[model samples]
Target: MKRFFRLPALGLAFTLLFSTAAQALTPDQCRDLLQQYYIDDIPQTVLDQETIQQMLEALGDPYTQYFTPEEYKLFTSSMEDTVLVGVGGTFSLTEGGLLTERVFEGSAADKGGLQVGDIVTHADGKPLSGLTLDEAGQLLRGEEGSSITLTYLREGKKHTAKLTRTAFLVPTVYSQLVDGHIGYLDCDTYGVDTLTHFVDDMTAFSGLATSWIVDLRDNPGGDYYASMGTVGCFAGEDALSYLLDNQGKYSAYRTAVESRTMYPALVLTNENSASAAELFASSIRDTGTGILLGERTYGKGVAQSVLDQTTLPDYFPDGDAIKITSYRFYSPGGATNDTVGVIPHLLLDDDLADEAALLLSTPAPAGDTTGYLRVDLEWRWYIDLDQALSPEYQEAFVALLEALPDQVKVWQGTGGADGWTQTSAAALAEAHGLTDYTRRGFTDSADSPYRASIDLLATYGILQGTGDGTFQPETPLTRAQLCALLAQALNCKMPSGESQFTDVDMNAWYGPAVNALASMGLVNGVGGGRFDPDAPVSHEQFVTIMGRLAQRLSMVMDLAWQNRPDTAGDSFVGWSDWAAEEAWLLAEGQTGLLGNSINLLWDLPQDIDPDAVTTREEAAALTCTLLQWVGILPELS
Candidate 1:
């Protein structure tokens, strides 16, 4: 949808001078052509430039391009078997607008006497107004060893600091103790030397590290093999990534051959932690080597292919570099990590925790000495294990779910004109040619809020509407639809084949859950030769599914299930204090928009009509949402 237009000088040259009368190339022919072009662009003299261009157009690659003379250095620089060096300073623009936060943990700013609260108004004589953090970054960054002057306001006084930038090989490994002897590591980038660096830092600090925090925040990416092996340090020599070709065949990849387990790790990341960061985090967590902290990483799990690097120097005119998505990667557990970032174990605020840090800093010992050390034992480390479980996942889902009651106001239980009983469940029967059937399900469980829950759940999956615009709740749930809902609510293992069920095929949308529900003991075959995967499920079946689902989710919900000392007096808003570590509360908000429904005293997910015949579209919405909720799918593209 986004189009970028250059001068089109090259476009004209490509069309007339290079493109040839096109012919439909077979997939194999396409691969061969690309390999040939990449390995060597020079072709038979009979093969005109136009023919080559036309042939190339047959293949699709968005990141694909031919390098120019000027881009040679850039190409070689990125693809080189070395790390990219930069001036190491993390900068920030203040909320009030003129001041900037320049942090030089150990960078040029530190050596230049730039303090933490310094307000940078200008960079190299250029005003810093209206410039975003990235723009400011660009002005601050220059070639290694270059000098830039920064004008700053320090404590209501103006000052200037000129600092010469130094080439910094971004060390992939960082370690320090945070929160109760937990080691915090900021491995921002993974390169060929990453594994070595990680092992060295960890091994050196093994004596003190009870647990660790690996910060992958803001890491773009580097070599795949290098990054995989880096985290594999904790997971041992295990499968880290799997490559699936266009044919859907999976090829597994393991880290460098080794076997070792270090301290328990907790990875910290944000939306900016990307590519190798996501890949590496998922590998470690899926393999049970660590818990993920912070937020869901920026997922970049696709593998890129480099073409023309081995040859075609003359055509490239620049140093050869071409990286395109060779394929997408799956986690060691076989879950697709592309687009959907690795979901975090905890979500943290984007802003730096400066307020908390400053508040904890001890006041200078009786002042008299202006330049005194403030040794605040409390400020010495930052990390809270209890904070990790709250306001992050479970309750967030519940909150979102609770917000939906208003959205479904039209659907009433007894309104024959259009009700919860007429829309969501009966749609399955109508679509699958079961017109005469009545919906055979209801419940008086707890507030008898069954119909209300149906309205909420159905609408969230976009299922709570009928052909005549009805919401019929009395309809019996269909087997296929039940599978669909189950598939969405839990991690539906993508099937390799139409499991032992002869009735279902890979094309069946619900085939994924046929084996899953069966394995979970929530479903059983009806009589001989009847998987009844498509037949209407009974109310009895619904209760069974609900109980099993409750049991299954109990594993994930344990941390969310808090002890409420006073159940009678507890209300949703007031429960946060009692449910200090509320993961389930957040997850409830995510699933079906139950966000505001946190005040419930019941373990409600246990009571929903699991046998309800969720529609295909509804199943898609549900499964996709739950996939994101459970960390199996991406919440953002």
Candidate 2:
């Protein structure tokens, strides 16, 4: 959600001269608000209120309250601004079948080979059969430059198209009278002309609704004046809130006496509701004017002010002035709500009845973790990376490098390390101190194609043959087995951390590796907070893991490499982008250590077999490959 101050330049307090006769704040209110109430310290009696306001603005607070002259103009201009960008296609998914109504010329759709009248069966790979057009549109829409895949049906065969979303205009406010007697205001954000549109809506629903519901879910705050104007519509001339400063001083802000509502009202909110929306809901409830429904409001008690550009040299001489949290706001009842948010009168649990019952019941204390995970567990993994890579691998890698320079830097140094000369498998094994070793179970297989790779793995303590002299080469590798092998190949230590997945027992053989991999951000559980450790590892999942391993090694080795640039971050780059690069490496005939390493894992297929369940032999070969790329083995001849 985009949060910004919405008031115009004319409303700026700083624009009015410090000694101007026409002022909104009284002498005491001005002195207290500027000198005593602000987060910073100020002189008792030295300069004018305008200069005092500028000094108060210098203090960094959550609410950047004071806007400089130039900044005030920009703040007001945003309210009247229009023009946005979005994905470049028109869609309609009715019972008649999902139809592409139109595809904009020269847009992402046209560039990606999408044509008008193409029947889209699925959006982002999910079937569009049961979804409303709006839902499907929402699925297709995303931030500019972010892509979504559409599994579209053209003629009789199925084809896929990926498109990057661009900007497009979308309304911020939606209001109507629902069920004949209920005025329903579905506000997406508080923007310029929002209050005007809202007032028009209210007048239209004046003789209609007996009750009202102002829905503020997913609202990223906008103009404070717009929100305050909204509050005035319900709270009347009452003291809406008090702003408190560091010096124990308070300033009262009253609502417009003429705009109060007399009807019973309910404000709908959710976890996404924040900033000005929180203030609006809390003020309504505090003034005994309305009841709050849904979850607790997002706790964003601090406000920001837009400072003028002229004051930039005074405090921060580099850029234009900004909003800071000068004062902490209090409810009309005198309760400070900063980190702690306004509690709802009714708790919504996806239904009104369930919410009513839950709200009435004694609330359980909140836990450290959000019980629900946000991943869609049911997504199909049939879309091949090679399909996207085969045609646009170069462009994809360039994009990947741009988006994730640090990860790419690690990958770029794969065979570029010093003292990392190409060596034979036997020589690489000897270099790693693997001397006293003998084949136990596979002694009879002298001509086995993978004997060298298998022996090298065993020598390095990366794998052990099956018991009773039987190396079960044909057995499928389970999730747990892969975790163990990868951990050993990476030379990672057994983790002391507890398991986060419900199915991963702490005492299990793979627990340490699983936990360690997760802690290192190399793996994530299959949703529902459960790690299906025993499930057979699929070809796609293994490659995904291998890609992560390579990137992790890249980052580690890059750090130790002399004069390497600092590019580390909190999270690893996404696997899809890196995996696409890996696909390119396989598609194009790249050789030496990197090529030999990839070949050891899987024979390069035209379209990588993402669905095929990999065998134990394959896992072992891949582990050997991992060792080779990290400079633990020589390039394959």
Candidate 3:
């Protein structure tokens, strides 16, 4: 059932101190805690382990770790607002030494003239070239008031500086007005004070900055409350994420603070961005408040709960504790970011992402040139319609550009590059009057092999884009999302009232679709009154759904099994036993529902792996093929 938790004042406060000499919890106690709180089902083999460490190892969850009193103290300190006695800069390990990534203003690193990009090769006369990032950091940090000498390289020249280490609060939020028009907020971590700092910066840039860029690259996430509040500054007060526990209970985690005046935002992320950092990016992107740029984020969607004496007094009389994975969280759109990280709207090199955002935010220059159309699909796409080309092509392009809805602005631009628009192949075809346009403007699907199928489905209003102007064809299609698409394709009447599944909220965008499919007996819940809606649908499962859909539509399959192609029987061999019959019916020539020969669903060299997850493009192709066979959509020329 849907439940709500009172947002805690301190989202993950680990402040209770423990004695250095404390006894460790027994294996049985550890197993019991895990059994009660862990998000996933624990195996009997894990419970059979003899020691606490062995049990945790067998559990195979890296995030769930048992810590002694001393280790726990250190862990808690790291999670809290950090106070470090070290050189005031974040460094990334490189072949030569540590490459300075960020230099805090008015700090020892800044005062020592250690600019970003400078390599710190030595610390206190000790060479740091072969050390790990943590080892290098340890060498640089010292007790407060201690002096250290750092040798660094700048522009291929060696330099030296002597600086004293002092305890300073690690800055979580860094803000500045970029190019006097873009408000740049760089969050190193989402600590307790991050939200307040972000608000102060937003208030400062209220009138001056027209656009904003949030940089979360290399940010190992911090406090959950702080992250949610920070995202609210852009996306407004809303349920930013949904958390599911082991007991089949779901909780909506909403933003705590009021939103600020919103503007066009570009959120930058990288592989190092994890946990709460991912939450911020996903919330912003899913809410349509901004576009994500840079590499895919580090996927860490599960939240850990700290178990100690205060929470479980009977089991833990000693100071030692265990941090156990308690809940698995999903994005605002009901997609889990656990193993699948958030994909950016535009993937660009880390160093070039900021520059690209700046260019995107800047307005095009005034009328110096004409006969050029600028298409704004998240990014700028300048197309020179007047370039030296055939008149028929130009006429078709002009007609296509003109046919676009008022929402997608196509205006005059200064001609630079020749015909460089981000318009998808499907959009161009539909615009040229070849197909009835349904406004499925997905710029990212131009090069997809399934472009034809995607275009057909989109033209018929059976497929949809990811709201942010691109079709993430490679992204895995979730069960709930697939259900929504199927409901649209079949034109199922929307079911009213509450959803049958406990995890599926009726108010959610996919709720009615799921309920409609469930009411039709075409879909089923995972178990325990839950749908597991966010889980990716496997290939065999997707085909099985299609078979069920075909049956529900009362479509006839008169072709006999003996009349099927010679390769069809072999093709069905690899499919799961449960889905084998349905899979064979949909293969190639059996039901005339799938492609044959050259465009076979399970063609050679790319033979079907039944357990593999179905991608959005694959789903589109299969759905489009079915719709065409059923006369819902026109067959491909």
Clashes of 3: 0
The positional error of residue 335 in candidate 1, measured at the CA in angstroms, is 1.4
Candidate 2 lDDT, tens digit per residue, 1-637?
1111122222453354232232232334344444533465655433243443544434423353433344544554444433344556666665534777445445677678876568888777688878776666667767788988888777767889878776543345556555476676766667777777667777788877666678787565666667777777766655456665565456777766345356645677766677778777776665666666665556666555444335334443434344545666655554433433554543332123222221112111123211111111111011122221234332322222121111011100112222122223233224334343222235433455666566555543456565465557678998887888766555455767568999998799889989877876778899999989999987767776775555434322222222322332112233244344443332222235544423434565444465778887777776666555443332221
Query: Candidate 1 lDDT, tens digit per residue, 1-637?
Result: 0011111222343443322322232334334545543322424332332443344454434334433333434443342322322344445566422343323245677678876556788888897878776676678767878899988787778888888886444344545544435555666556666777777767766666655667676666667787787766777776557775544345778787453445556566677777778788777767766555455566566666654535543333334334445566666755655444665433333232212222112222231322221211111122121221234422322222222232221111332322222223244334434433343222321233244344434333324234454544444557876766665444344556557566766577667677667755667777664587767754334434443343233222222333313332233332233232231333242223544543221224444333344333333333333343444632221
Error of 3 at 543 (Å): 1.7
lDDT of 3 at 538: 93
After superposing candidate 2, which stretches have Cα over 4 Å from the reference?
1-82, 85-169, 310-319, 350-637
Residues forming the 10-long window of minimal summed lDDT in candidate 2: 374-383
User: Tens digits of per-residue lDDT for model 3 on 8-76?
Assistant: 212332323222334478877887898999988999999999877678789878889777766666665
- Best of the candidates, lDDT: 3
Give me the runs in candidate 3 sitting further than 4 Å from their true place: 1-23, 90-101, 109-165, 363-375, 378-412, 415-449, 452-542, 545-637
Better of 2 and 3 by lDDT: 3
Off by over 4 Å in 1: 1-58, 63-76, 79-88, 95-107, 113-162, 165-189, 200-211, 245-249, 257-261, 269-274, 293-301, 308-325, 339-341, 346-637
> Candidate 3: lDDT over CA atoms?
0.69
- Candidate 3 least-lDDT 10 residues: 1-10
Per-candidate TM equals: 0.48, 0.37, 0.56
**lDDT, candidate 2, at 223:** 62
Better of 1 and 3 by lDDT: 3
